[model samples]
Target chain A: MTETPAKPPARARIPLGQRETVAGYLFLLPNMIGFLIFTAFAVVASAAISLTSWDLLSDPEFVGFQNYIELLTDDPLFRTVLWNTFYFTFVSVPVSTALALGLALMFNTGLRAIPLFRAMYFLPVITATVVVALIWRWFFNPDFGILNYVLYELGVDSPPNWLATRTWAMPSVIILSVWKQVGYNMVIFLAGLQAIPTTLYEAASIDGAGRWQRFRNITLPLLTPTTFFVLVISIIGSLQVFDAVLVLTDGGPANATRTIVYHIWEEAFVFLEMGYAAAVAWILFIMVFLVTLLQWKLQKRWVHYEA
Target chain B: MTAHGMNRRRFVLTTAAAGGAAATVANDASASSGAVSSRFHAPAMIGQAQTTLTWAVPGNPDEIAVYESLAEEFMSANPDIAVTLDSEAADFEKFVTLVAAGTPPDIGFATLYNWPSFAERGIFLALDDYIAQDSYDLEDFYEQIITPYRYNGDTFGEGELYGLPKEIAIRAMYFNMDIFEAAGITEMPTPDDVWDWDRFIEMTQQTTIEEGGRTRQYGYVQDVRWTFWQIWAWSAGGDPVDNLYKPTMSTLDNPAVLEGYQVFTDFVTSLGTAPPAAVTADQGHSEMFAAGLAASYNNGRWMVPLFRESDFRWDVMPMPMKTQRAQTLSGSMFGICNGTDNPDEAWRFLSYVVGAEGQTRMTELGLLLPSRKSVAESDLFLNSAPPTNNRIFLDELEFAKPLPLTPIYPELEKVINDQTDLVLIGEKTAAEAVAEMHTQFNALLQGA
Candidate 1:
């Protein structure tokens, strides 16, 4: 009893509770400062710069809301840029999620080679986007590429020049994007799959449920949260696609594969229009914000939760 | 010690290495003065009040070594001044940021196309005062090449000189001797005979050998990255822009310009004699030529070092003719940053490197279409064999035109290429693409 009462006073010497709080904040100080300086400061600075007319060399001249107005009403290329971004997001996000879900479902079985197959699928997710894009460029080559060779062997006459033609260039980029992205989503989906109780599946199987029925009734209803998560992030990621566009086609074949982020980089670095680039960046930020908000709001309709 | 040594250190080396990089030789009894061989590893420090000038060295290890040697030599001459070589300043954005931050290198170099745009923003110090004071023969350099680097408050040429040309690159055609002979092309493209666009196309078509669907050997392949295709329009008396320095209109809509654009675009699209972007998609067109997959490749002297390593036999010739004759005149250049503290010291060093001796030493890099008239014409430049037609490079300078670079050059290039790419891919005709060019170019050129 004396020792038990003495424990409170003994702990008072070190002050673990208060010390932990201070130490936790102390440990986080470096990262917090970095985030505030590099990211938060940049974000606010760009928002201010969006209202100015500054080339890199000159002092920023305030232009109010004129840049946003110009982007919306004047710049013809902005329309193309937005359209291309939407096309990429809408196509790449859905295709990647669906393919990843399918991969998760197939590999969920307790097969001996599951780990091997998982690693093989996840290999591209870890490879550098630049290396992947460069290799994809070779594969996209119409004449000497393995892609065209395979197509030829399949008796498909006159395969399209994947990166050189306007119609096929965006699709080629989307294909590359989906391929690089699918593995990451699949791993996430696998985690979601593992969390689902096998007992529920077994009960459903005993109830004379078919493979399709159980997948629909129990698995799908439970997986809605994961699906929603995957959809939101994939959509956000697709809108900001830059490295692949830069390395693979360079927004070429007559600006066919030019995306919003790619245009922002070009305007800021290549054209030296810092203010204009910030305006475009703000536009992109708003777009991502609104899309994510819509998905978050709409999740109530399809997203299921358990008690 | 020699009593005259102290006085000789102050004697500036404003002259170009009229002979070689080591023009100072050992004539000076002072060992710290241009004794490159013995003092190259470390320039012997002699005098005090040492002013360190930072110079941006933007090249490979071999290039850095040469530039470092140049610095060592300069330091030996002016022992009072030390030079620091910074490779990071080589980046355009970083350099501009450093300038804006008010801590730019004393001397900086960038592609010639960037100088006018950079100068317009007052990024570089105007060297007119220095040139006048030194009675430095600006005439020692090619007038046409140097003229493009001049910038006033508004336009280029007829203004204060902004910088000096570092080296030059003039375009010529490279034909694989093996493929040409195999295709029965005995007569090389003669600068005198001056084959027309139609004749060039016919010759390429004859050499093109296709098997079933695959092109076994491409007749010709040109990289679409550069503005080298302007050779077609230029030879036909068609100007892509009204003036090279301050272009207000995109004259691609002109009859002759369209004729040039159409003929060049037709080679890949309608003609199919030259490799399309699809054929050369995996490899650069230059690499494709060096590999003997193409009969001829059109480029400047920059490709010489790469082509030299190839096992195949190849030679050079001037490009085909239209109504007029012309080729490209574009290269990199060096300038003193506006923020430089030691302008006098920087100029002495800059002038020497771009001068005859410096250019002769640079030719060791194997691609100095030397900026100095003396160096370009000297036996030092002419002796590099295998090209055989080196004389044509100098002769073409009469018609060499720099690209119409302006404050909006990077944007202008993207605008022009975006539309031209459409034409080349057969998505649109020359007239259609030019219509787009006119719309975009007016916005860019006049916007400035």
Candidate 2:
């Protein structure tokens, strides 16, 4: 009667979707916690630090907008670095993206050895930046560099000191960066090109469209989304260019190649002006954010979406 | 609540309780073992718990090995004070970050130029108390080497000792003997020879060779570093700053300083005694000298190890004087971190490294001049060199002045260097660059 025929215990009923949601959140907890702790918190902390005068070794003092004022109004080096960053971003992004698109188009042909050629082109992209920078430094050397040697053989008696002269230093850095980065962007472009429906190209060709016309009408418009993505990411990356400048010229030969990131690093770590560095970093962030927003607004003009 | 919900809650509570019990048991087990061990050796371990000290050093692989062995010897001597060597490969920025992070190594090797900044910021612990308490023989170290580590009364090289001397880096003229002989120079300047700036320039011009509308051989290679320029300015009886310890303004406008600055630039732009700034920018001065393309290069004693591998016969001579003979003294030093919990242990390690033993090891390595007078004077340094005139470094110490040791020295150096580059590359005149430098330097000083 234990025996009264005890009914089986009622199980708590949970909706399938609710359980799935709980499980999903549980699964995401680790990564969410890590991102919050490391990235988000660090960013917020740095923002707060921007309003203070923290030398890292000593106690932080609230300096309000002094760092910002000094950076904007008084610091000539900051201006130079900002200009250099802008110059690098404006020059490198467009040139590299165009070059990448061109390379992608060339390699997109169904050749049997296409993989090998792609790998060969991508080798510099995979190589360490420092190693690449060092190699290029030697190549750009006016006396013993291979670049100058080739220039000399080609009847140019005096090749400019590529990394030394202010006029050439930024361009030299741009060239090296483009060469190293074009392969990466090319891979992205290749993926974008592959995703384009072959029907459109075929239709264009059926209409007696030439290669250039088909590319201009079909390929470029369809690839705009990828191009926009590449542009935004490239601009952000180029603005933060530090490693090549550091390894190649050390912002040297009179601070010609010194970019914003390099200046921030020097201010933060070298000069121990953490607050100033934080201020510079925030300024960079604001610039990047505004630029991205502008790009979003401008994307309506160029970026096309396939229905 | 549903029966299943109650069961689930009970199950969770039971699991948590079990986990807590298991954790307690594990913790107790460890605690029991720890207690037993402590009780067994409590008499011996009363007040001598092990202290692990971290030492950060910046050096190449070879130098790191030397430092490791020094640390090893130190640990062996002091068993209670364990040491961990952190090699940074000469990244000063990383070292500063460590200090800023407040987890700085107990002892850190830093550049003498950075000493004043660290001292002023209270990053480096003042060693005067430790020295007085230990009765440490401060006299053993060369005054010039230790001078950079001193900061008192708002002046460097005059007050409390913040760091012990690690090396004596005195710049001297390293000339290629073969190049001089090939140029038909019979008389070579010795350390004892009082060669003036004019005589040095004459010798440089005599050795310079031009062929096929190109300078095949450069007479001298001047380093582009601010320190080398400082030596030139000092030799000309001009200085970048009026005060050695507390620099306030640029003295580059001084007549002698301007003359020295002009002469240095003329070596590249006008005289062609040395390669233009463009060529040197492509190639290092030491590299050019080692390649025998340059007859002479003025650099520190650290060049010995690099030049020893060269095929050419090279020797050191005193820097040519203008108004007076002057050389810039610079080197790395080890200081205890103020935030270190183990100051005594740190000082013990520091003293061991900067003491006679460490100096001897450095001397044997031939990578640096010994900071200790006895070690520098010993045959170990004098005999262990490719440049036979090793004594020139020691002799020059009498006239070697420490670099301006303001907290803003790096900024000041940047201003001077940038303006000087313009002059060297023929973009600006000496007066114009110096005037610009003065303006910039005063602004920086005021800000500091």
How does each model score on TM-score? 0.88, 0.89
The candidate 2 chain B region of ten consecutive residues with least summed lDDT is B1-10
The CA lDDT at B168 in model 2 is: 71
Task: Write down the worst ten-residue block by lDDT for model 2 chain A.
Answer: A3-12
Question: B253-324 in candidate 2: lDDT tens per residue?
Answer: 788877777788788878989876556644456778988889999887777877888998889989888888
**DockQ of every candidate:** 0.28, 0.30
The collision pairs in model 2 are: A1-A4
- Superposed by TM-score, candidate 2 places the C-alpha of residue A147 at a distance from the truth, in angstroms, of 1.7
Estimate every model's Cα lDDT from 0 to 1.
0.78, 0.79
Candidate 2 on A102-216: residue-level lDDT in tens?
9999999899999999998899999777667756866887766788788888988778878767888899999999999999999999999999999998998999999999999
Where does model 1 sit among the CAPRI classes?
acceptable
Error of 2 at B201 (Å): 2.3
- After superposition on all C-alphas, the RMSD of every candidate to the true structure, in Å, is 8.9, 11.8
> B271-360 in candidate 1: lDDT tens per residue?
888888866755657778888888888877756777888888887777888887778777777889887889999998888777777777
Among all candidates shown, the one with the greatest TM-score: 2
